[model samples]
Structure formats: C-alpha cells, structure tokens
Target chain A: MATTSIARPQAGVRPEGGGLLHRLFGRQPAGYLFLLPWLVGFLGLTLGPALASLYLSFTDYNLLESPNWVGAANYVRIATADPRFVAAMRVTLLYVVLSVPLKLVFALLVAMAFNRGLKGLPLYRAIFYLPSLLGSSVAIAVLWRQLFAGDGLVNMALWQLFGIEGPSWISNPRYSLYTLVILSVWQFGSPMIIFLAGLRQIPVDMYEAANLDGASKMRQFFKITLPLLTPVIFFNAVIQTIDAFKAFTPAFIISDGQGGPVNSTLFYTLYLYQEGFGFFRMGYASALAWILVVIIGAFTAFSFLSARYWVHYDE
Target chain B: MTSSAAAIPAIHQPAERRALWRSILIHALLIGASILMLYPLLWMLSGSVRPQDEIFGSSSLLPSSISFDGFVRGWSGLQVSFGKFFLNSLIIAVLATIGNVVGCSITAFAFARLDFRGRNFWFALMLGTLMLPYHVTLIPQYILFLQIGWVNTFLPLIVPKYLATDAFFIFLMVQFFRGIPRELDEAAMMDGCSPWRIYWKIMLPLSLPVLATAAIFSFIWTWDDFFGPLIYLNDINTYTIQLGLRSFVDSTGQSDWSGLFAMSTLSLIPVFLFFLFFQRLLIEGIATTGLKR
Candidate 1:
C-alpha cells in the first residue's frame, strides 16, 4: 500500500556530486551513524526474525525439538483438525465486523460534534481521548471484566434500578464478546481524531454556501460533508479493520490468556499467542502468522483497489 | 450559493425563536454526549479508589469518601518494585524515542532527499512491510531472542527500536522531510557541506515539529506495549510496568480485587503524567497524521 502510495514521485532523478561514498561520507558519516542504531535493529532484529519465522513455519519445532522439516504438515493439521483455530477465526471476524463499523460511526459523530462550537473544546477532546490512552492495558481490561462481571458494576446498576438480575457478562459465553466490542469502541479516539481532521478539511466555505442556498443541515451533511469526507472515511475503514484483526492485549488480558469462557473471546492474535508462547507450537503459530499476513495483505490491497472511487487527493 | 443578506435577512443578530431554540437544543445534546463519553473513565477512577466492600455498592460514579489505600497498596506490591519497573519503562521509552527520532529522520532524509539506487524499491519495501502483521512473526522472533540468550532482558524490548523496524515513524518523517524545501540542502551542499552535515545542520533543525511528533508517539506506544514485554521478559526481575501489572491478575485462581484495583490506580499515575505532559503535541500529532495527503 505504501509502495503504491510512493510510486508516482519516483522517476529519473538528478545525481549528487562526487561518488556514492563521497556523498555518503563527504563532510560526515553522521547521517549513517545517526541511523546506526536502527540499522543494527533491522539487520539483527526485524529482517532476521522475519525470515526465521518463515523457515520455522515449515519445521516441527517445538522448544524441545531441533526443528525438523515436515513440509505442509503444520498447515494441514491447522486446516484439518484445529477446532480452536476455527473458533478463534470466527471470534476475530465477528470482532472486526462489529467493532470497526461501530467505531467509525462513533468517531464520525464525535468528530462532527467536535467540529462545531463547544465551550472548553480541548477539555472535551482530552476527555474523549482518555480511553485510547487506557486501552489494551491489563488494568483497563481487568477493569472491563469487572465492569461487566455479574455482580460487578454493570449488574449492580441494573439490579439496583430495575430489580432484575444481569448475567455474568464477562464470564458468560453469550455476553463475553461484548466486553471486547466495548473495549474497541472505547478506544475510538484515534479514529475520532482522524475524523476530526477530516471534518476540518471539508471546506467551511462549502457549508456556508449550502446554508445560503437554504439546504437543511441534514441535507448539507449528507450531500456535501459525507461525499467529500469519503477519502478520510476510507482511510479509517482500512486502518481500523487491520487494527481490529490484530487486537491482542485486551483479549489476552481479559480472557486471562485462556482464550476463555468457552473460547468466546478467542481473538486471532490471542490464539496466535496461545499457539506460539503458551503451547510452544512454534511451527503451527508461524503458519497462523503467515495466514494472518496474507489475510491482512489481501484486505489492504482490496481497500486500496477500491479507494480510487472514494479517497480524494489534491495535486 | 445564496447571498447572506437574502438567506438570513438579519446577518449579525439571532432570529427570534427558530434559530435560538435549535442552537440551545444542539448545545444541550452535545453536552449530554460529552458527559456520556466521560462517564466510564469517571467510574473507573472511582472504582479504583473505593474500598473493596464498597466497590460494587450502588455503582457509584463518584465515591462519597475517597480512600487513598488503593493508591498505596497498588504502589507497594512485588519485590521487583514499581519504581524499578517505572525506570525500566522510562529507559525504554526515552531510548526508543531517541532511536525513532534520530534513526527515522536519517532514513526519512534518505527517502525524501537523497538520490540513491534501490532507494525507491527500498522505500516501497518499507511501506509494504507495514501491512505485515507482527503476530505472524512474533513466536519465531521470540525464539530467535531466546536462542541468542537475550530473553528476560531489556535488549529485546529496546533494541529493535534502534533499527528502523518501526515503519510508521519512518513514513511520518519522510513526509515531514518531503515538506521541507530541498533548496536548503542544495545551498548547504554548494558550500562543500556533506549530505550528512546537511541533514544535521539543516534538516534536523527544521524538522523539529515532526521529530517531536515522532518522539511523543514512540514514547506513548512503547510505554503502553504489553505484548513485546509479555513474550520477552520471562523473569519478573526485568519486568516493565505493564508486565508488572499483569502479575496483578494473580495465578492462585482467585483475583485480588482490592490489590489489583489499587495497582490499576497506581499504574495510571505515570501514564497520566506522561499524557498530561505531552497533551498538546499528542493531539496535534494525531490530528496531523489524520490530515495526511
């Protein structure tokens, strides 16, 4: 996606003076040296591990064994036998489908509301954004569990007011997933802030003109604001979908690393966590990882391919 | 577009009942929405401080009497120490910021300014890699660290940051670098200043806003990261604050409600302070990233 984003600018370019070494080393090797730390990390950390994982996916390498090649066996087992993998996939898909749209709409509404006048707007911005800061913290996830716990806050409120019982929300398989959905929605600040910027970019002059023409606020928003904001909306949709799929901390922390309450909250990344670190099924985990990469890649490509109709950019 | 005079006969003053009531209604609705946005956080803060017995008592959003023991008890657990975990977070956060700011800027400089072979291909590769979810590579990466005997150490936590493994910062820096005029680099070069000198003397100084943006982001993300530390730091001795909080969950099959709640309150302080300190930049950076071309 980023490659295609950059492709337009690269072409026959002007050459620098002297030689490659001279350009690199001329007055100072300072830039290269400045980048030394990260360069070391890339060579030693990222690229090295990335390739290692690809190789590990083909080997039956539990921690106890020296990785023996077992071509496609890990893939076959995952595809054929793993009920948990299917469950995790279902949970993750539900999570992404439910959370991303809700988050986008909430963000859009908050952004629209924030775009207009409000006294102490910065304070409102800070308050709305606090959840994103708290997000994925074990503390927050723990708090979420409590908030939804049967005898906890949510139930206590319900029982007190309505004289009715509330089920074990976080522990009940029926409602456990709501906690994850709520967690994602609560952290809507990033997208909300993005939407706010997108809102600001829609020319105020257009709204002013629409008002002059006697268009109702409802009509103006639908006809003018929404159309122009499609690009930003598209961007948020793609990014949020990717983020929703990769969400781990809250699920792992909330489910107590068990994928729990009958695997109701067995999010994909959490399941990946289980296979890799918990069970030490490193090979299976790597296969899971590659599948995730492919899934994310395909969806990202899909969004970009579709974006030409929506995302507007000025030259 | 209709003329202002024709659309609103009276431009400066409010119309009688029509506009006035609607404006009042909208503002009231906005305030109601804002209150809803805030209620959850308000409840969490109150719950973290309430006595264990009183916690579920009436689901109070605000405690009648604020107790301080939660903060005290939360801050006091574990031999590894919250202060040490704090320092660990501090060291990792600060170093990661430095790595991101300096390293990403230099690389961004290469992508935005230099005319090197494979530059476009490499930039494209870097961007393409952004879509690669880290979960797939996580286990193998952990194993590599385990093999290298770097697990249970801060190296795994803090080292990859030194390498431009974080693509977003690099992309952000590249955009900022692109926004900067190339004449500055050319003028410096004409004076026999090397490309490296040009970056330091010219680019770095000018890119302060974007660099601060990158640094602030890296700090927040690193401070909050749990997955990285969860996998790498097996020993409680080397745990960062986030890892320390995970221990609050307790493995004895019984949740320590009071202690955990107390610790949650305590865990929030540094993060709260960090957020407050950089609030302006935090909003500005996020808002700017959204407004990207």
Candidate 2:
C-alpha cells in the first residue's frame, strides 16, 4: 500500500519535456481551485506557524514582550539546568516504552481471540472499544482520578477480592504514572482492531499447510502468523510510540495540571504546555516542542530503518 | 457443513465434546474479562445516581436509595448551567464536522482525481504535516490566534476545520477517493459533466462512507477536545463541556465528585449514541486505514 501510493505520481509524470512555465501553470486550474482551502491553510496556519515556532525556539519571547534573539540559550538551559524538563522527558520515555508494548501485546492477544470467529464478535469489539472512545475525554480522566483514589473502587476491589489494602494510586509518586499507563493500556482497542484486520488478511491456506505438517497451534502461530504480521506490528509500534510521547490529557487531568506528587505524571507535552502557557515561557516551550519533534522523528526513522529486517511484505 | 459432519466418524463424539468444552472455556474467559472491562463505566453510572456522601462511601454499583439530586445539582452547575456548556460544545462540534466533511472531501478530490502541476508535492507536504506534532504548532498557533483576537472565541477551534487543517481526514478521503473507479469520472466527462458536477454529483455521493467517517471523527474529537478550548476560550460563558467539567474540580480539595460524575455521564450520551448507530462504519474506517494492503 505504501509503495503503490508513492509510485502513483511517477505514473503521472509527463515524458515529454514541456516548457518550465507551461509545466508550472498546468491546464487544470480547477484543480487549484479545489485545493484552495488546503493551500490557504497550509501556508497560513501550518507552514506559517511552523516557521514561527522554529524562530521562536531561539528567542526569549514571553508573549507579553517582543521576542529577543538568544541563540540556543533556551535549548542550552533546558539541557543543562532544567530538572522538570528532564523529569518530563524521563516520564514520557518510560510511558512510551512501557505502555505501548503492553498495550500492543494485549491488543494482539485480544485480536487473536476475536479472530477465532467468535459469535457476536462485533458486539464484543464494540464493548472492548468503548474505553478507547471515552479514554481521552476529561470526564474519563476525572473518573479515572476518582477510581484510583484511596477509598475508590479499585482499592475497594483490592480489599474485597484479596483482603489487601491498596494505596491511593493517583496520589503516590511511585504509582501515579503507572495508573496513567494502565489507562493507556485500557484503550488498546484501536490497535486491536488493526491487528484483527491484519490477522484476517493472512491467507487461511498457510495455516492449513502448517496443520498438514502436524505443527502445534503455538508453533503455527510462531512460524506462520508472527512473520506475516510483523509489518502491522511495526506500523502499530511506530504510531503508538509517537502517540504515547504526545500523551497529555490523562496526566494533565489526573494530576490537576501540576504533574503532581513529584512530577511523576508530567508527560512531555503537558510539561511543554506548562512552560508555554502556564508559566508564560513560550520560547522555552517552543524549544521543548522542537526537541519533541526531533525525538519523535528519530523514533519514526529508527522504526522504518529497522523495519527492513523484521517487517515482511509479500511480493 | 453437512459433508464435513458426514465425513467425521460417530466415534469422534468425545473429540467434538472436547472442542465444545474448549469453546465454552473461551467464552467464559471472554465474558469474565468483559465484565471487568465494563465495571468502571457501570460503577460511574451507578455513582451518578447515588447520594453525594454515599458515592465514595460505598463501592457498590447498586445504589441502595437512588436519587435525582446529583443530576439536578450537576445540571444547575456551579456558576453556569450545564445546558449552556452542552450547547457550546454542540455548536463547535457540529460546525467542525461540517467544515471537515466539506473541506477535506474537496481537497481530497483535487488530490485523487484532478491532474495539476505540483499536485504530488502538495500531497506529500500534506502527508508530512501528519507527522508534525501538534505541540510544535501549539505556541505559534496560539500566538497567531491571540494576535488576531480569536483567543476568546470558537473561531480558533472551528475555523481551522473550514481551512482543511486536519490532514488525517484529508488523507483518509484521498485513499477512499482513489479506490473509486476513475472510469466513472471519464464517463461523466464524456457526457458533458464539468469537474464541479463530477465532484458534487459523483464523488460526494459515492464517498458517503468515508465522509460519514470523517464527520463522526471530527464531531467526537472536537467534542472531547479540552486543550483547544482550554487555551483559546477563557470566559466561563464560552466554555465547552470539557472546560466546565474541569472547572468543577477546584484542585484545593473541594471537587463536586457527585456532580462531576453526573455531568460526565451526561456528556458521554452523544458519543455513545453515535457509536451505537455507526459501529460498522467506525470499525471499517479503522480497519481500512491500518490494513489498506
């Protein structure tokens, strides 16, 4: 799908070398007309702000004053002096590394269960997906905060089920971030749906062939299904990694926007937001934003580069 | 099915029974897991009806004596009525949905069907924008809107949709439009149909599934969006439902837990209804986007 989409424009490239001006101003003016909204948005909203942010990263703008040139000072300060920045980065990296893999594993397991052609599979899928639909909302985050409180339902369950007293999950510094990670893992429905589709796409004949060789079900999965499903896994990993980095709402709402209890839940985006909006350190925040872009870009590039070894595409 | 049953020997009954047992065990596990998964939501629903003091006091999902007090107090809200917030969210969500559906479809039509110079470049640029973190654009976009006096208005939240700033929807529509047979456009063109007519009559009608998908997503995302309203709209009068809920938590130990849960349950109704009605399209959209190959 990726290769075919990239190859499409090449097919449209004219063989004959038309004049540069002619090629520049094609006959299809209506195409440009159709593209008017996106073009204006691209320049005015996206590209314009993007360029402004790049410049803002090097300045000391506080939104109250004019931006002053301070070449790399914000970046240096963040790298050298900012404890909260480091904490936020550490928190976010831990979140991505922990939540994403756990979520993906759970998603794959559920998808495999659903792929067994369960009756009322649609109903189950919807039931499982309900959390994801509500997961990012302020309401859910608020609910989550209460649910993990000392006297909340989770602790109540812990006491009733095992006679063990549970601590306040949201208040304790050690457990606060894990609560958010659990929230993330609960919303694994999107990836589960994606995995289900990928599982469906695997040829049934391959499984049958494995069965004819007297391979066990686990062996069939390991030898046949896993290899075929690697591409989807890689795709989900890259997307989820980026998503986990940008996570904000849960942490923000759960910690009441302070990243409370020693900054355990201070996601990178939340910290960036605090610097930019809450503290009015717009330039520092812009620098943080650029760093995030670089980090996400690096992860994406790394996944794509490593994909060649593991992600299989059938010819 | 009959042939398979006939081919199996009558002595294979124990094996079939064992398969049945396995199936029963799987179902039991799934049912148990589903209950655990749905418990929080159910507990929230029950808590909404429970008395204020009884909410956290008892962990039981069933309220011994249910009351409408939470709903009444929550609806009345702290300073402003929840109705106003709901209206604010609805207006923004509806406008954003319409803007995304119309603008994204048109942009996608141009990219997928119309031939023009720099088309590929623009398309690639649009795709690249998908990878750009919203944080990267956050400060500058806020500053831009602030300078333009759109800070305290819905314009910051809604206008971008009209300008097709959501490249994800545009990309989805593009993929959908590409799947549509080009011969339809050719056939229409041969019959004296203009590009506008082709778009309005053929593409728009044929692309209903994707358009509906985009519209539903736009509505849900906008309705649930807290950060945009948090940054843009400061006035409580103009606050969305999310902001209203946030305001309920004073963060100094005086949160209206019962009222918050009531309002939260109310807030989820539209989304729940939408999901129930459009489950197939929603699932298909997620599946097709991820597993296009």
Q: What is the TM-score of chain A, computed separately for every candidate?
A: 0.89, 0.92
* Candidate 1: residue A256 lDDT (0-100): 82
lDDT of 1 by residue, B117-176 (tens): 456666787786666778755776777778899988888777677677888888888988
In candidate 1, the residue pairs with backbone N, CA or C atoms under 3 Å apart (3 or more residues apart, or in different chains) clash, namely A37-B162, A38-B162, A38-B163, A289-B136
Off by more than 4 A, model 2: A1-24, B1-11, B251-255, B291-293
Report the lDDT tens digits of candidate 2 across residue range B142-256: 9989988998899999999989999998999999899999889766665556678889999999988889988888888999999899999999999999988888765324346
lDDT of 1 at B74: 62
lDDT of 1 by residue, A1-315 (tens): 122222221211223344565465532234455445555666566677778888889998899989999999888988999999999999999999999999899888878877876567787788778778767566787778777877777788888889889898888898898888988888888788888888887888999999999999999988988888888889889888988898888777777888789999999988888888888988888989988888888898888988887766652
